[model samples]
Target: MEERDKQLLKMIRKQSEEGMSLLIDEYGGAIKAICSNVLRNYDAGIVQDAMQETVIRLWQKLSQRFQVKKNLRAYIYQTARNCALDYLRKYQRHSETDFEGVEDMMQDVSTDVEREFSRKHNERIVHEVIKEMEEPDRTIFILRFFYYETVKVIAETVHLKEDNVESRIRRGKKKLKAELLRRGVLNE
Candidate 1:
């Protein structure tokens, strides 16, 4: 942690309103981005609710006696992810397609229940594979597929050239498809 983050931690440990405000001022964008990325399948209201829930969870956790002192950013990111996933679980909203580019990964099922089950299972597998991916690839995949960000926006966010972003996304999809195939989850 930097000196600035240390100061923020100190303030947040006090559980004061100003401390919470400082925390938000420092990490609000990241929190919102995490929530938006995780809850992209849902509406703005759901994302906003998850963001608020993340903030509340942060406040509760940071004020604890055994709160995280180091790697505060990771904790915040994990909290945002958890809160968004909780909303997903609460509402049982699933993505309509198997991400943006992998629509053919799922085979056509005869029954709606089987289709839903297959989609949820395949989605879980894809998420697991993406989580195991390396840095720039993982971040690029999440931004591109989960957040539905354009290649140019992804390039700016990840500080890469547009071509580089496109290639990374392509490679990420290839790797994902391979993983799904290896796991016998793909239609092919």
Candidate 2:
């Protein structure tokens, strides 16, 4: 455990408001990102609710029971993921396709260094490709894939026709895939 983490632990165990504030400030974005990745396209309220539940769980349960003080990030992430998924199952808001992808996402990462490195390299290349895309195309791609928004919602939000949105999504994906393949990120 780093000295900073130890201090954070001390502050939280003592129930200091500042400690809680600091904890929220430190890990809040990461927790929200984790929730967003899992819960995707659910309203922002769902994400916020999941985040709040994670904080509460950390404060109420983990703090008392946890002995090791190395990192709270992973614990917070797991709690947020569970909270978001529970909310989803209880609500039944996702499509079959979305649900299918998430099961694979929840699987643990490979320990193989080469595979992990290649995966990350491909991810970077994909992000770079997205960054270089034109305006509505970039927005459309991010809305559809990253936020997990549906074609209808993306069309309405982007003020494009549904057909146009779908076309752009298809085109954007093709472009990204071609770029990745050319860069040797994908099997041809």
- lDDT tens digits by residue: candidate 2, 102-161: 656556445456677986788899999999999999989986776556687678667899
Deviation in Å, model 1, residue 99 alpha carbon? 25
Model 1 accuracy (lDDT, Cα): 0.80
> Which stretches of candidate 2 lie above 4 Å from their native place?
93-188
Model 1 regions more than 4 Å off? 93-188
lDDT of each: 0.80, 0.76
| Model 1, TM vs. native | 0.55
Instruction: Provide the clash count, candidate 2.
Output: 0
Candidate topping lDDT: 1
Instruction: Superpose all Cα atoms of candidate 1 onto the true structure and report the RMSD in Å to 1 decimal.
Output: 8.7
Judged by TM-score, which candidate is best?
Answer: 1
How many collisions per candidate? 0, 0
The digit string of per-residue lDDT tens for model 1 on 23-107 reads: 8887787778888877777899999999999999888877785557566766877888999999988777345432754545444
